[model samples]
Target: MSQDSTVVCVVCGGPAGEPVYASDRECSITSLCEVVPSPTVVRFCQACGHVQTTEMPGIEAYYDTQYKILIESEEEDQLYAMSNGQKVYRLDHQARTLLRKLTPSAAARILDYGSAKGGTLKRLLAERGDLRVHLFDVSAMYLPFWKAFLDEGRWATYRPPAAWRGTFDIITSFFSLEHVARPREMMAEIASLLKPGGTFYGIVPNTFTNIADFVVIDHVNHFSAASLAFLLRASGFGNIDIDEHAHTSAFVVTATAAVQQGTVAGIPRSEIARLGSEVERIAAYWRNFSSCVREFEDGRTGRPAAIYGSGFYGTFIASCLSRPLDIRCFVDQNPFRQGRRLLDRPIIAPEALPEEIGTVYVGLNPVLARAEIAKVACWSGRRLDHFLP
Candidate 1:
């Protein structure tokens, strides 16, 4: 597979870099049965050490309907579910830290870009009642959530009047940039929307540190610390502060819009080499992972099996395996998805997982997956397998 020369590095406008992975199989954010196949190719940009794919086709159309369906498929009250193991539960802690570093201001106009279901904004408003909060997302499916919980005057669906330009004191994009086709353009637009000296705080997957992010089909851009800094600076941002330790496998950055165009720095030679090595390492890991999954599936051929966690990790496993596993059901904790069918397999809640299921693949982030599995009372004596390290 070859890189499209016309599509340059999103951060530096340099040449399309190196190909890291290509798959002819379907690559959809949703499950295999629900989506049509769109072949995927991921590349590594040496210019700024960013990893991205060729711009996806019909991205707007896909996000409008398919993405909205994905949101609706989840529990309606999931945003408020602050359970320890839930995905967005940590957003409360993360938001508190990011907001504290902000310069104290009265009635600050804060916008949460890509605020799906308005969860972060809800948490923010609770912490800072004085903030004039706003919400924007591609889909309006969460409008009811906004109407019920947020200030009526604050929310819009990516349509603000011309007068609203450069009016915001702070803008945040959490786990949204990776899904965008043109990250540079997205950053520039956000810069234009902010007041002079306005801060932009973003959180994206730290691919340099997390291998799992590499295969996430929905995430087009895999940003490292260096890549994110370069993209922010090129988009007229300065006084940048990036924290890789504040969150696991994510880069939390705080940048202010500069009065003039910000300077762009080159990626270090050592850093470039390291990124290349990491790319190879991840590719190797995927090959090994596929082989391991196949072997495990073969060993348990006659027995009924199920996968835990129907989110990204489990969905990726369902989508990528070459040989079909005898997966009878998908075990998930989210109530909305419990009765849905994914990959032609019924999605059941943990309590619904039958005793006939001899083995359960723990398809979740390895760090806390074991503890999460232990919490399920019914799976106490069943065999558990780990697919991720």
Candidate 2:
């Protein structure tokens, strides 16, 4: 858990300043089931107010061959929310948000960089048939899914063709930056791929909003507003807009590729100190999370329980348990995850959960855990104890 002084900030190329959080426990990846037991150390850059983790070994190979996100089926998607008793999926919401933010002109050339399965772009194309869309990613595992909507010429693996350089009007990345160890390099490539005055739109996790991101091992860079600005400016982007509240636990950003490289501004000392303090507070939370969960379990030993989400939080809860066998199943509202298995426990819908289970661990975002759990009408009259994060 020692800090590597040679590690530089991905945004500003400054030395990694100080260690903020370090852990030796098994950490979960974005693809919930994958776990890394190696020690994790997070460092904060004083110059740019950026927080980043030590890169995972063989991270490139891992993402290319091992990482598997929502690839079960073409219809599978993460649950965004429950709108008036209707299930709203994530891709649909993302498409709506992007369209509202930037409406492309007819026949505009657009590419979804690091676009796994190109779900968001597929949804967008369905709305605007005149827009020309392309897909790019490191892995070819999702090529089958992309083939359904895009022609072979419109998609590429490893890297896009040289002919694609400076040809795109719009480039979008959806929750891909955090996983990359060299974000600055990635941004430079994105800039080269765009025409002058072209826009780069992206969504990255906001660790300050979603504390779980602080401990996710696969997320190499944990971006702050200041760090994001630095990244875009250093990569020759201008007219940048970063909106934190546009999406839950994410930052929505749009930056235009400038004809000339933009000047990088120095962060204020006061702001650096403020960000450092905030990062320390979040680190302390994860340091004590396991102990808190253990204490909660101690009070209800021998009682059968269920986890209320099949994502990262739920997997983390199971990892912290003293007797994981006590948990009978995982309850999820998303139909895609209902029939799956996490930690050898069946993931069932709320209505399908056995009535004998007396306790429920709400393994969801702490900011929305309680309210989401309450929305399940099936658990209304049942005398079940709920452990909320």
Best-fitting candidate, scored by lDDT? 2
Q: In candidate 1, what are the lDDT values of residues 1-389, reduced to their tens digit?
A: 66555667776778766577876455544322244466656788887888886556777876665665335522343222325655454557667767776663888998888877767667777887888888888877778878877766777885655666899999998788988888888898889889999999888878666666776666788887788888888899999899988777788899998558836778898998888788878767765665676666666545667888776667766665555456789987867678988778899988888777776777776566777777887766666554443
lDDT of each: 0.73, 0.89
Pairs of colliding residues, candidate 1:
none
Candidate 2 on 167-194: residue-level lDDT in tens? 9999999999999988988999999999
> What lDDT, from 0 to 1, does candidate 1 have?
0.73
Q: Least lDDT summed over 10 consecutive residues: which range in candidate 1?
A: 73-82
Best by TM-score: 2
- Measured with C-alpha atoms, the lDDT of residue 380 in candidate 2 is 92
TM-score for each predicted model, relative to the true structure: 0.87, 0.97
Question: Candidate 2 has which clashing residue pairs, if any?
Answer: none
The backbone clash count of each candidate, in order, is: 0, 0
- Give lDDT: candidate 2, residue 114: 96
Native-referenced Cα lDDT, model 2: 0.89
